[model samples]
Target: MSKIQFKAMVVTEINDKQFSREIVSRDVSTLPVGDILINVKYSSLNYKDALSSSGNKGVTKKYPHTPGIDAAGIVVESKNENFYPGDEVLVTGYDLGMNTSGGYGQYIQVPAAWVVKLPCNLSLKETMIYGTAGFTAALSIYKLIKGGVKPADGNILVTGATGGVGSVAVGLLHKLGYAVIAATGKPDAKEKLLKIGAKDIVLRNELDDKSGRMLLKENYAGVIDTVGGNILATAIKSTKYGGIVTCCGNVASPELLTSVYPFILRGITLYGIDSVMCPMDLRIKIWSLLANEWKLHDLEQNVEEVSLEGLNTKINLILQGKLMGRTIVNLDL
Candidate 1:
C-alpha cells in the first residue's frame, strides 16, 4: 500500500507571514502511523478550518498541513479489534486536523479511540453534514435540557444563528418544540433561518447592549451563544431568572467582559461547551442522539455540497463570515 496515491489539499508556508493552499498527490505511506486507516468520503468546513488554511498559526502550528476537523468514511485497514476493513466510521475534534493530517485528504490514519462507528440510520454524508459544528450545537442543547430549561418555559435565543452551529441548533430546537429567536449579523439570512424553524429573527446588533445597566428586561428562558464578546455578555444580562445559557465559541471575541450581577441577582446558570476531548461514552451517546431523535431530516435544506477543489472558496467565505449554513466537502466528487 505504500505505492498507493491519494489526493489531498495541502497548505504550505511561503514565509513567516504568508502561505499557499493547493491540491496535491500524497502516498499512503506518508500518512501518520495509527491503528485505523480510513478512506474519507466527506469532510466539512468550519471557522477553524479557515484559520488553519490561511496560516493562522494559532490553529495550526506547522506548514504543509491538512486542515479539516471533521471526517466521515469507511475503514480501509485496522489494527484494533473493535474495527475492521469496510466498516463505516466518523471522526471529529481530537487532534485529527490540527498538527495532524486531516479529512481534507482522501485518507486519514488515526488512533482507535478517536474513531466512532457510524450510528444507525445516519449516512456518512449526513454525519459530515452535522460535523463538529452540529455536534457542538447538540452538546449545547444537551446542556440546556439537562439543566432544566424546557421548551415550554419560554423562548430560546440562538446567537450567530446563520452560522453552522447556530443554524443546526435552530433546526434541532424547533424540532424539539422550542420557540427559537434567531440572531444574526446578516440581514438576508432571515428567510433561511425562518425556513429552518426559527420563530423570530433579531439583528445581531440588536442583541448588543450599550447600556451601563447591570441587567435588562427578561425575555428568553435559555440562550445558545456561538459567538462570544458583547453578544454573550448581553445575553447573560437579559436571561430570565433561573435561566440557562450555553457558550461554545469565541470567534467574535475571546475576552468576555461582563459583571456577575446576572448570576448573583437572577440566579442564572452559565455553562461552557467544549466538544473537544469529550468523554468517549458521552460522545457515543451524543452521536446516537443525533442519529436518532435529534436527527434533522431537512438538514439538506440548509446544506451546500462542494468538492475538494471547491473547498478553497468556502474557506475564504467562512473566514469573512459570508458562508451560510453548512458546507460539506465531498472527496468522491
Candidate 2:
C-alpha cells in the first residue's frame, strides 16, 4: 500500500514548562521503524499516558509524542513472519507510550515481539477496555495465587478500589470466589463496588494508619495495592501471617515507610508487580486467563468509551484520582 495517513493525539512542549495535546494527521512513514505496523482500532487511557501527555520527563523524555500505552488492532504490514496483514493483535507495556510513540494514534509500528494475537472470546474493543490496568490487576492476582493466597485464606483487600486496576482486581478476585474488601475515598461508590463483586467497602482513610505502631490488626489474607506510600505500608503491616500483598502503582506516593516486623514477624510477602517488562510467556498466559475464566461479566458497567477528542478530560481526571474504572479510545470516532 502507499503511504498511510491517520489521526493521532500528539503532545508537544510549548515552553520551558508547558505542554499541549492536539489531534493531528500523521503519515505511517513518520512512525518509528518496526517489524510490524498495526492499524490501531482501539486504545486506552492510563496513568502513565496521562503523565506522558503532561510533559512528565520521567515518563516521556521527548515531546511531539503520542501517549497511549495500550492498543488493540489488526496487523497491516509485517516484516516478521509471525504476523500478517489483517491479523488481529494487541500490545501493552514495554517502552510503549513511554519513550516510544504509543497507541494514541490510529496506527502504531511496533516490534513483532511486543504483539500478541487477540485471544478467542475477546474483541479488539473489549481488549482495549481491559487495557494495561486490567492486565496489571490480573498479574497481581496471579502473583497472589502463586504465593499461595487462596479464597479461603481470608478477605483480599483492594486499595484504590474505584480506580482501574483496583476495580478489575476486585472483580477478578471475587469472580474466582475470593472475598474482596474494596477501599476507596468515594463513599458514594459503595453500591457500585458491591455490584462489581466487592463483599464490602472501607473508606481509604481507614487504611492510612497514623499510629506509630509497627503493626496493626492482621486482617487481610492478600492485598492488591494500586496505591503506594502509607497505604502500601499499612497493607503490609495489616496482612495476616503468611499473607501476600502485590503492589503495582505508586499514585499515593512512591515511598514505603515501614519496619521489617511485617516481613519477619508476620511472615508476610510483598510482591512488586511490573507489567511493563513482563515475559511474553507469562503475558500470553495472563491474557488467556483474562479472556477465559476470569472474564468480567459486568465489564460494560465499569467501562466508558471515548473518542480521541474526549481523552484529555479523562487524562486530567486520572491524574487527580477522580476517574473510576476504565476508558477505551475508539480510533474510528
Candidate 3:
C-alpha cells in the first residue's frame, strides 16, 4: 500500500514548560507493531487525552505524540486471524493515546486484544459519541446493579453531571428507570442536564461538604461519582445504608479525604471503576448492552462533531472544565 500517508494531531514539547499541537502528515509505516491496522473514521476527546496533549508526563511519558483514547473505524489490514480487512471495530484505553500513537490520526495500529468488533445497530460515528466516557458510565452502572442497587431503591446521584461520563451515566440510569439527581457546578446547564434524563439538579457546592461530621443523613440509594476528592467523600457519607457508590474520574481531585464511617457504619459499598484495564469479556458484554437495551436514543443530542483541526479548541475547553457533553472527531473532515 506504499505506506499510506494521512493527517494526525501531533503534540510536541517546545520546552520543559511549553507544548504545541498541530495537524500534520504521517505515514502508516510509523505505526508500532500490532495485529490490526484501522482506518480510523472517528474519535472522541477525553480528560486523560487532554492531560496527555498538554504534556502531562504522568499520563504520557513522551511528547511529539498523538492523544486520542477512543476510536472507531474499519479494519484496513490484520495479522490476527480474528479480524479481517473491511471489518468494523473500535479501540479504547489500554495504553492507546497515552504512550502509543492514538486515534487522533486517520489510522491506528493496535493489538488484537484491544480491539472490539462493532456491535450491531451502532454506526462508527455513534460509537465514538459514546466512546470511553460512555463505556466508563456503563461500567459504573453495571457495578452498581451487580452490587444490588435497584430502580426502586431511591434516587441515584451522578456527580460532575455535565461532563461526558456524568452526562452519559445520567441518561443510562434514567433509561433503566432510576430517579437521577445530577450535580454540577454550572447552574446554566440545568435544562441540558434535565434533557439528558436527570430528574433533579443539585449544585456541586452542596456535595462539597466541609462539615467534619463523619456521617450525614443518608439520602441516595446509589451514586455514580465522576469527580473524586471531597465530592466523592461526601457522596460516600450521604448514600443510604447498604447503597453502592462507584468512583471513576478524578477531575475534581484525586485525593479523597474522609473517614471510614460510610463503609463500616453504613455498610456502603464503594467500587473504584477502572475502564482502562477492564477485562475483554466484560468489555464486550458492556458494549453489547450499550448497543442494544442500554443504548441512548438521544446519544447525539448534545454532542458536538468536530474535525482534527477543531480538536485543539475542545481540548483547551475540557482542560478548563468549560466543555459539556461529548465532542466527537471526524477524521474525514
Candidate 4:
C-alpha cells in the first residue's frame, strides 16, 4: 500500500537549548513502529505537552516530535487481535507524545497495549475533552475514594481548581456529592469555579502557609492537589486526621517542602498519582466510571476547541499558566 500522508505539529531542535514547533506533513511510515495505526480525531493539551513542544528534553529527549500526550481516534489498521480497523480508541501516558509520534498528528501508530477502547457512553470528541487531565483527575479521585474518604467526611479541596485537572476534579467530586472547595490564585476565576461545581472557593494564598507550621488546623477531609510544592505541603498539613491527600501535578513547583508531622501526627495519607504506567485494569475501571457514574456535564464548560494551526497560542498560554479548563485539538480542522 502507498504510504499515507498526514499533517502534524512537529517540534524540531533548533540548538542545544532551543526548539521550534510548526505544522508539517509527515509520512505514515515516519510514525514509530507499533502494532496499531490510528486516524487521530482529537487531542488535548497538557503541561507535559507544553514542555515537549518547548524543548524540554526531559519530556522529549528527541526533537522533531509531536507533543500531545492524549488522543482519541479510530483504528485504521491493527496487528493485534485485541484491536481492528474501525475500532474507536483512546491513548494517554505511557511514552506516547514523549518519544512517539502522538495525537497531534492526523495519524498515529502506537503499541496496541497503550490503546484503550473508547468508553461506550463517551463519544470521540467527548473523550478528548476528558483527555489525560480528566483521567488524572479521575485517578486521583479514585485513589481518594479507595482511601475511604467520603462526602460526609468533610470538605474536599481541589487545588489549582481552574486548570484542566483541577477543574475536572472539582466537577467529578461535586458529581459524586463531595463538598469541593476550589482553590486558585486567579481572583477572576471564582465564577468559573462555581460553574464547574466548586461548593466554595479558597484563595491560593490561603493554601500557602507562610508561617512554617509543621501542622495547621485540621480542615479538609481530603484534598486533590494538582499543584505541588507549598500548596501540597499546606494541604497535607491542614488535612483532617486520617484524611487522604492525592498529588498528581507540580505546576507551581515540583518540590514538596514539608514536615513529617502531617503523616506522623495527623495520620494523613498522601497518595502519589501516576496516570502513566497505571495498571491496565485500574485504568479501564477509572475510564468506565468517568464514562458513567463519575461523568459530569460541567467538564465541557469553558472548553476551547482548536485545530493544529491554533495550538501554538494555547501551548504558550498553558506554559505561562494562563490557560483555563481544557483545550482540544481537532486534527481534521
- Candidate 3 per-residue lDDT, tens place, 1-333, comes to 337999999999999999999999999998888889999999999999899999999999988998899999999999999999999999998999999999899999989999999999999999999999999999999999999999999999999999999999999999999999999999999999999999999999999999899999889999999999999999999999999999999999999988888888989999999999999999999999999999999989989999999999999999999999999999999
TM-score of 3: 0.99
Top-lDDT structure, candidate number: 3
Q: Which ten residues in a row have the lowest lDDT in candidate 3?
A: 1-10
Q: What TM-score would each prediction reach against the true structure?
A: 0.99, 0.99, 0.99, 0.98
Candidate 1 deviant stretches above 4 angstroms: none
- Model 1 weakest lDDT span, ten residues long: 1-10
| Candidate 1 structure, TM-score to reference | 0.99
lDDT of 4 at 102: 86
lDDT by residue (31-81, candidate 1, tens digit) is: 889999999999999898899999999889988898899999999989999
Error of 2 at 157 (Å): 0.3
Query: Candidate 2 has which clashing residue pairs, if any?
Result: none
Superposed Cα deviation of residue 283, candidate 1 (Å): 0.7
Task: Name the lDDT of candidate 3.
Answer: 0.95
User: Model 3 misses residue 279 by how many Å?
Assistant: 0.4
Model 4, 71-155: lDDT tens digits are 9999999999999899999999999999988889999888888999999899989988998999999999999989999999999
Model 4: runs farther than 4 Å from truth? none
Residue 257 in model 3: lDDT: 88
**lDDT winner, 2 or 4:** 2
